[model samples]
Target: MKVLVLGSGGREHALCWKLAQSPLIEKVFCAPGNAGIAEDAECIPISVNDFEALADFAQKEDIAFTIVGPEDPLAKGIVDFFEDRGLKIFGPSAKAAQIEGSKVFAKKIMAKYGIPTASFEIFDDPQKAIEYVEKKGAPIVVKADGLAAGKGVIVCDTVEEAKEAINKIMVEKAFGEAGNRVVIEECLFGEEASFMILTDGKTLFVLPSSQDHKPLLDGDKGPNTGGMGAYSPAPVVTPELEEKIMKTIMEPLIKGLAQEGIPYKGVLYAGLMIVDGEPYVLEFNCRFGDPECQPLMMRIKSDLAEIIMAALEGKLAEKKLELREEAAVCVVMASKGYPGKYEKGKVIKGLEEVGRMPGVKVFHAGTAKKDGEFVTNGGRVLGVTALGKDIPEAIDKAYEAVEKISWEGVHFRRDIGRKAIKHLPPKVLIFAGSKSDLPIIFKTEEVFQEFLVPYRIVVASSYRNPDKVRSLVKNAEEKGIKVLVAGAGLAAHLAGAIASETILPVIGLPLATGTLGGIDALLSTAQMPPGVPVATVTINGSINAAILAIQMLALSDERLQKRLLKYKKQLAEN
Candidate 1:
């Protein structure tokens, strides 16, 4: 089928590339496509903002499917326009697009739908915004109500700064007509993540969580740009937590939009701040996010054409969109002094060399072919992405590629997975309670690498084999173990044995199998003898056991400390 893509950015290019590969697609066309996209699909000259021209082109070309790539067209009701003329389009209607088009509208809908989000107030005047800032105190967030290309929001550290921001947005017209209204929101401190879902206005197909680097500089410093880099399958969003996000954020938003008579279709992007195991909506984007989409598309195992068609045909609920288990990372190469003033027209080199690396893909963002050579055309240039079996491998591959490709003044974060590395080594000292706990403990060890932690798994029957447990516990101290996590079931004595043997912290994980469904083990683990402190997690809590060990290790290691802080911040944001 003929597919028409509406946009001119890197996201649209990637969509066109993916769609062109589908056997079901006979032809792929992109409106005003870039140099990179022109290699894959036919580029049309019609501007994406020209709704009338786009509709006319789709009809004339007999395009069977139209995919809106940018939010501007969706906000202008391009999908609705196409549908009116009996053309199939994959994107939300203008009414549904308000979730991203207007911050005030999104916040209001979130509040009405019982969606968890930071408390916020909308303002059209400068004085009211300043008043809200003064009332809310410093370190709050100020956002322009309409789109400003992801540079519209500011995190003000003081009330004065907030006031100045309000003046700039509402009075000075820093963002032009887009800043006619503003949203003042409570500052939520936590780990921020991007979650996207493909919906047919009813059923939702969730994608892997991704973390985007919004700040222009490393370590999250400097002004926000249009996503300098991104990585997918973020460890921050645990499987359990993803369920909470789907139930709390995605489901409610979809149902809420449908209830309002706008059967939302296409990608619904949620910028979430996870706090204390809860995810709050930081913002919403109607279309796929830039760098985030690059890595997500790389990791998705399902066919893009089929997914979009399913959503447009109102059959998304019956379909299951599969994603690869591998992780993906993308690092952005920017022009000098991005998010402000930056030099352009610099020739980029080593692209072919970097792209040759296994699992590496160089997706051009702000680039153009001038005089027979690729040159930088925008602030953010190329997105160097790679997929791996795990996050570290992905990081290693991505950075390797980043080193090869170069333009003037390209920068990236060095600590992308620095936090995740701590969990790579499991610090648990599993003390097998009798010979019975051996099999289960070994099984737990087999899956230890899945949690990305190193393990010093041991087999020692604490009750019938007290001598072995004592020797193992003594050796554990010499090996510099900060915490002892013992996995034991019924009449669990492994925890007590280890706790009594060493002054280090001990954690007990109860296994479920016997008469009480492991409650007996739980009580045994929890109720340690006086002066012998043992932190007891739930039954089959080996995962928590490893997590606790990592937390304990973070107390002394600065790298681990930062990771723990990030994890805590992510938890708080959710």
Candidate 2:
């Protein structure tokens, strides 16, 4: 199979590199790729937003899949354009991409769905915006509703700063027509983490958590560029916090979009703020983040082509993802005076030397092939990445590799993953076979809460959402699902199905329903084959199922074991 990647940056380079490694992919092509990406795949001169020409090229090259890497083309309806011509593509539609294209649209959706986000309002009139900002006070965020290449947002510390930002964006047109409308929002301050997922509109597969440094200078004390650096497996996004983000932000947003007749069909990136241990939405991106993508692609251990193909074919629910345990860090090298003015045609040196270093990769962003030499061609130039046992080691290796390559006006942040070295959570899954059984089945949630165990309750009928069930079970072990409690009535094939997909311990609760008062259910649950066994409890045994789950989890947790022992003692004393 052949694949085509859109965009000309470090993200595109990383994507092309990963896709080229797939055994299923015979060839890979990148549209207008930089000098670095040309080494990995065939570089075509076709523009990313040129839908007609790109489609023609894809058809000519027999491209099986096209992966979009930047927000500009996606915001321009690139996916819809490709699908209209009967071509397969990844990314969201123009309407759905608005979540990242227009801050006002995203805020409205979040407000409608009760998704946690900052308070704000939209305005086109400059005076009204200024008045609102003045009333709301300082320390607010002023943003351009349209794409500005990451420079459209401004954080103001005073009313004067707010007014100036509005005047520049709305009146002076600092960002061109992009500032025609603006979204003024309350400024949220916290440690920011990036959560990206691949979805088929109905089901989702979460990727490793990463954090990107957006400031142009060190210590985060400068204007925003595309991104300066990034590291994966962010410690701030603990397992419990990740679940909260998924349930509150990602799931609701996807469902709400589908409810509004717009089914999203690609990657959704949620920029989050960890405030007092609670996650809040900072922003959303339609496509993969630049520097962040560089490191994430380095850490992913699965075949990139298979995962993308599954999503395009609506089989994402059945695809399992694997990521390396080792941490990855990417330090971006940029032209001098980035997020402003800078020279671009300086020749870089020592790329081959650094690329040969163990566990290090040099992803080009803005560079051109001048004769036989590679020279800088854009503000953000390269993503220097390295893998290590932890974030600090990765950071050290990344900086060491960065030191080997040099140019006349190269700049980078030395403190890339400095703030992310802190701490991590676990989860249990409860699957109910049918909606009728959900009433008694939901009792498991109360017991889990009393035991202070984190859990997810999902309704996946073997007949209805079989694909969803298969996916949940297939990926359970990697997701840290200690135990799976499956409840059903009649045939009770839910536990059997889960057991077939994963090695995780599965507990079955046969409900007291149907003609035989759950005798038929208990018999079906307990009669699994020798190789696939499910622990069965008594009829209407949701609470006992919860207890069983806790017991299994307590094996690895001293605190939980103590709690369980206390609960058992209390039961005996009563």
Top-lDDT candidate index: 2
lDDT of 2 by residue, 201-249 (tens): 8788898999999998878988888899999989898889989999999
Clashing pairs in 2: none
**Which one is best on TM-score?**
1
Error of 1 at 97 (Å): 0.4
Stretches of candidate 1 exceeding 4 Å from the true structure: 417-574
Which runs of model 2 end up more than 4 angstroms from their true locations? 424-574
lDDT on C-alpha atoms for all candidate structures: 0.81, 0.89
Per-residue CA lDDT of model 1 for 273-305, tens digit only, reads: 878768989999998999898888888778889
Cα error, residue 138 of model 2, in Å, equals: 1.1
